[model samples]
Target: MTEVDLHMHTTASDGMNRPSENVRMALEAGLSAIAITDHDTVAGYVEAAQAGQTLGITVVPGVEISTVAEGQDIHILGYYIDVNDERLLERLRQLRSTRENRNAMLLERLRELGLDITIEEVIEQAGKSASGDETIGRPHIASVLVSKGYVASVHEAFDRYLGKGGAAYVNPPRVSPFEAVDWIHEAGGAAVVAHPGLYQADELVERIVRHGADGIEAFHSDHTPEDESRYAEMAARLQVLVTAGSDFHGERNGHELHAPIGSRRIGAHVLEQLKARAK
Candidate 1:
């Protein structure tokens, strides 16, 4: 009943809804606050914040940065960032460029596999969903595949060909975890390790904590009840705040949007600590 969802996505990075539409959805869902944590892009935050204000919902400026550690992709979430931060924007622009180049290579690989999809088609599908300067992502490509009947589902598309080590997987350049934490801190936000349970490693949690992660996404859509409990305990032991959200990417991910508002609420005290650090 706290009415806060700190993790979500929009057309800025693979989510189906535009920023305004996502804000409307949050309002309709009775959410008091929501964060547009788009992958590698904050392009949706300004519009989302404006729309949230119009709807009387609080919007948290956020970003999900992709990082690599020990050869696996890890994501870090930054909340309460200054959306207009020039250095942050520059870094995000570089990341977006990397994503575009990686997607192009993936598309080429898919074509080589005899799939008739093209970068233009993917961009066209994304344009239908995006507002302003939002960038497209692999989820957008998966949607195109689904619509074309080339794949039955987004998960299927990823598992069959786009996920790490999959046929079309193209590794994008990643910033070091330390650098990611440093930037998020510099941008006046709290950095959290996303979905620790999915990593299935306690050592990774330790490594991230050592690297300046202030919190852990203890409750997530992909975490089981036991997993959640385990992470909550781990966070407490490590003296880090525990946060939660649905990681909602919208309709393309069937049954995902149902992760209700405040489904796994974080403490206001934790948010306060984050705010203090950001200041």
Candidate 2:
């Protein structure tokens, strides 16, 4: 049985590990392949691929795009993406810039609620939790809150201020689900709905399929046995490919679902299927 983890992160986004380190970890864990599905950016693929080449482990060029569906956050994972696709790169650049503005707005809201943390503080916290190069996100801010004792845990920080309906919650700018799938296709990748278990809607799987999802993430670190069964059934019914991954973001205090690479046994055939779909 081959092992592959098709969902992972690096310092390019919120994960603590660098792309090279992620590859090294994969090799150490005896993974046959791993994907660098960093949030919204394929910037880490180059380093990961280089490391994979040296280590003889397959590195799948991938990205996880955050989108919105019926006001809920939806993540779409793209496998075998052309990392140099101009359209994808430009859109990711815009998203990163917008996220910076959103972080500022969130901080202002925190101030309104009497939390006097600065952006610098959040950056410092992220620096401690990141690989020296990363796009600052709410996790970094939540880490800052945790370090300051403003929240007992990252989950607490989110519940109190960052989560939806929290006092400091700021709506992020995101593309639509259809747009996300189309962009992944435009980049010559197979678009799969990521971690269907994370969404509250019971019909999200079918909805994503309707939006042209080529596959579904049937196995994820956050997914329970029941969730996996449900997603597996949905993928079968929808006649789409099934994928699995640990969604490794490296070890962090608040980052749940932190598993070593290849913790989920993704069949090698799944990789072959994704590659077949790749242009």
Candidate 3:
């Protein structure tokens, strides 16, 4: 089988594995292609692509942009993006600044609530656990909380405190869905909605298709078999490509690194469509 996994993360963001490590894992898992779809950053793609070449694996350049629709967080995935596009890099830098500020505010809120965690503590925790040059995210913060016995798990930490509308929830600045798709196009990539059923309403899928999404993440670890079929049907009706991935985040997610790699299979025709769009 020609295995292709279009969604994954690395230490460049919150994932436990580095780009090189992820590539190695994918190779071991018998994947033919993989993308390092780091959150808001393409910093790891070059390294991942290089490593993939060394291992005779195809590394598709990708990024996952955080967006909001109807007050819910949505993720958009870009495949075959030009990682060197200056405009994309500049926007991502701005987003990173917003994330840093938000993290600082969340730390302060936790401190005010007598959580006894400091920015320095959080940074230390992140540094200790980071896989490579990955930037620290809330998962790192939650890891710190869990280590200190403040939360039982990352999910609990997010649900009770750091998640949207939670106690320490602070909305970060984001690109609109259209803007995200445009930026991906500017970077010479095809944009797809990642895991649509996670939080979006059924109608929102059609809205996204109208907004320039070229594909849908139909096969995902988070999707049930029924949901997968639903998304596939939607993609067919909309004349959009259907992609698949594991959404791997490594050990931080309590799942095996690269678990189900290539299990979510995208058809060769869909890959061709994505490549054509990227061109």
The window of 10 residues in a row where model 3 has the poorest summed lDDT is 126-135
Name the 10 consecutive residues with the lowest summed lDDT in model 2.
125-134
lDDT, ranked from best to worst: 2, 3, 1
lDDT of 1 by residue, 203-242 (tens): 9777888778888888888899998999888889888888
State every prediction's TM-score relative to the real structure: 0.91, 0.93, 0.91
Model 3 segments more than 4 A misplaced: 128-134, 253-260
Clashing pairs in 2: none
RMSD (Å) per prediction: 2.4, 2.4, 2.6
Q: Rate the local accuracy (lDDT) of all candidates.
A: 0.80, 0.84, 0.81
Model 2 alpha-carbon drift over 4 Å, by segment = 128-134, 253-257
RMSD of 1: 2.4
Superposed by TM-score, candidate 1 places the C-alpha of residue 93 at a distance from the truth, in angstroms, of: 0.7
Candidate 1 backbone collisions, by pair = none
Which has the greatest TM-score?
Answer: 2
Which is superior by lDDT, 1 or 3? 3
